[model samples]
Target: MSSRASAPTPPPSSPDTGALPMVQPAPSGSSPQGLALGLSAYVIWGLVLPLYVTALAPAGAVEIVVVRIGFSLLFCLVLLAVLRRLGELREALRTPSRWGATALASGLIAVNWLLYALSVVSGNVLQASLGYFMNPLVNVLLGVLLLGERLRRAQWAAVTLAAVAVLGMTVALGAVPWLSLGLAFSFGLYGLVKKRLPTPGHPVTGMTAETLVLTPVFVVGTVLLHGAGQLTTLTEGAGHFWLMAASGVLTAGPLILFSAAARHLSLTTLGLMQYVAPLGQFLVAVLVLGEHMAPARWAGFALIWASLALFTLDQARQARLRRRARRALTGSQAHA
Candidate 1:
């Protein structure tokens, strides 16, 4: 449930090209700064966000998501104006394809946000954390299914392990973990849509457009909730009001930091760093939230962790090979 809201990186294609595509590595002096920013973003998502959502006591999940979207849209617009990026947003939207993609991405992300909020408020933080843990594997599956991408053997094995974990959990729990699957798949599809944007523009701009597309629906819902005496923002006291308003900052701040991190870090580093959020969530769920980890669930999580280890190792090995190849090519060119 942590804000998988970071700017989307395009997924890798078949192994004939490479197992994982490498973005430019962090500049020699900038890696530390990038690491810090990335860590901060993920920590806020994993550690801070669950606690923040739980504090919104009087508000239900729907209301929280509504307020989040509205405030997030407002915050994003202000950012566009202040950064003078409104024109860029306009240009991106001018393309019909981009607008459609943005709209779809908006819907997908809203589902993800709503599901995450529901999970946190319902004492299902452990499930939410599991979803995020499953997300990267879900992304790889999505790449293969939707993007016609081929997976390496290690990737396939990792994916199979994740599948086995899910199946085991379903059998043990006597019901499918639909919440976790919904969260994983929705965010994965959202990333896919964002990656497909013909004109992705700036991360903030894309966020603004997505929110703008959905703001009207949320606005109508807010009005309906108020009429039904369900909207609690104002009557819930000044503390609640501020917390509700702060959703905007909580939503957008990490996104900006993530975008900055992406600029300085290689895709490999960023990919590995993504686990920080889920790991934090896992700790918070068990320690702070006091969610029980049944033995079956523990086994499921162990499988997932093992799968992620395999996936990460494969990617790291590929990245090292790429770097060495680049170095050799540079040396040869210099000698020639």
Candidate 2:
């Protein structure tokens, strides 16, 4: 919920691929717990971020991001120790290729967090929602362009509709929605690189490694910001200081929750839950934040929502077909 909205990597197949593969369902033993944790994480991300924007007032986005990175690394280190996973971190460090990959991923995620913080600080939470809403579609394009994945007709139509929506938004705002686009693309690419990394299931270790890579820069930058009178956490009194310090938990808690959820939920269920964050952001922007949405902007949002409907339906249909096929094959082989 810290606006470091994490996207799990896209499947090797485009989500819009005509023949979507079956995603395994959650194990019964853990489904309830996973659903609870995942929902909590998503809700915090979507709803709590706006509040943090207010709390982080007087602190520029860059300073907040620096604190977030520094404290998150500390939190991750603690979790690693408690979980007895320091060996995983050591193993990752020993591999030179992983070092490079994690370094790159660190930069990408930091960029993502910075951009998201900037949008929120600028009172553009509505745009942030739009960006996340466009994220899955962006992943489709990334898969096609980067991974040589093919998109079916439905997928193409969805992308086209999204384009039209972007055009509408541009007209409504008298400029392009760069903040939205930046968030979508940055997070999309982050997920892509993280997927290719050697780290498999150790989210804590992987994140710790990435943050460790960024720690020095953030540490030095914080000092420079303080010297320049740009940093505000200390002068802001105990209340503000604690809130700033809480960035560690704000940044790391949801990730741990998400990792727990991933182990016990189907990709489909998780996909559905993914929208909760954006939807909450959208509501907060309009209702609580009082960001006005002109008719044109509303029309654009409606179109994007429609496009998502088509995309989700296509994915569901393909998954069902794959499941039936697998069942039939299994039955025939059993008889044989």
Clashing pairs in 2: 1-45
Q: How close is candidate 1 to the true structure, as a TM-score?
A: 0.90
User: Compared with the true structure, what per-residue lDDT tens digits does model 2 show for residues 9-98?
Assistant: 354221100111223446324478878987887787788876776569999889888888888888888988999999888888787888
Q: Report residue 233 deviation for candidate 1 (angstroms).
A: 1.2
- The global C-alpha lDDT for each of the candidates, from Candidate 1 onward, is 0.78, 0.77
Please, what are the lDDT tens digits per residue for candidate 1 over residues 1-336? 232221223342110000011234453334788889878888888899989999999799999988888888888889889999889878878878888887887788888888899999999988888898888888888877886677778888999999999999999989898888998888877776665656354667777777788888788989999999999997889999999999888887877777677678877777777888888889999999899999999999999999999988887777677779999999999999
Shift in Å, residue 146, candidate 1: 1.2
Cα-based TM-score, every candidate = 0.90, 0.90
In terms of lDDT, the best-performing candidate is 1
Worst 10 residues of 2 by lDDT: 12-21
Which residue window of length 10 is worst by lDDT in model 1? 13-22
